[model samples]
Target: MSKTVTVSDQTGTEALAAQLAAVAKPGDVILMHGTLGMGKSAFCRAFIRAVANNPHEEVPSPTFTLVQIYELDRLPVWHFDLYRLSDPEEIHELDIEDAFADAVSLIEWPDRLEYLTPENRLDIHIEPGSNPDGRVFILEPSGDDWIKRIDQLSRDQA
Candidate 1:
């Protein structure tokens, strides 16, 4: 299933991230796809902060570092940026298989991974909206489980 959410400002974007974080847990994978400046990093930062329960935590983009690991009270999170990767095989060096085993993974530019990504995952596509500071998020679930979770998210927000 799929759903779209419009975020008007940075705060709204963060709120959306926190809401998503509430339903996410270890062993979950969230793939984010968007062009540069589409707020993918911002959404990730907010989600990481929420999961860590530290609103002031310093969450940096993994563009250069490749992957950033955060140990939240609930579960560990592995945030990955594959934009700089020249080959998908490079992911093996990072031991991503281990992280995906029992961690919440937020991946940006996941196209590089292609079919390597698990069958069941949440794919979030971000795009520019009509408002100057607005962002439109298109969420596509990979399985029935995610569809139910998305519905719960909507009900929670309501």
Candidate 2:
């Protein structure tokens, strides 16, 4: 099963991110999909902040760095932006292996992962909503673990 959430503004998006963060754990993979300005990076920032339990936590987009690892007491969070990725094989250089095996991973431009993408993951596709400032998030869980975990989401607005 999947869940769809509609939010009227950026605050709503951030709230949803925080809610998801409350249920996330180590080794969970979140694949973000959307075009430019769809707030893919914004979602990741909010998620990382929530996981850190620090609303002021700095969560810079990994657009240039490719990967940003957030060290937390619960577990590390690897935020990856593969927009500049020239080759899927380059993911190794970003230590994606470690992210997949031991940490919570938030990947933007996940299509760039190519064959390196994990099978067990929660794919979040962002789309424009009815209003100009509104947004729609389609969350699809893959693999048994993800499917079960997704049910724990607090969102039922869909």
lDDT of 1 by residue, 10-45 (tens): 887898899889999788899999999999999999
- The 10 consecutive residues of candidate 2 with the worst lDDT sum are 149-158
Q: Write the per-residue lDDT of candidate 2 for residues 80-100, one digit (tens) a residue.
A: 999998899888988888899
Cα RMSD for predicted model 1: 1.8
Model 2: how far residue 124 lies from native, Å: 0.3
Candidate models: Cα lDDT each: 0.87, 0.89
Q: Give the TM-score of candidate 1.
A: 0.95
What RMSD does each model have against the real structure? Answer: 1.8, 1.4
Kindly state the number of residue pairs that clash in model 2. 0
Clash totals, every prediction: 0, 0
Tell me the deviation in Å of residue 71 in model 2.
Answer: 0.5
Candidate 1: what lDDT?
A: 0.87
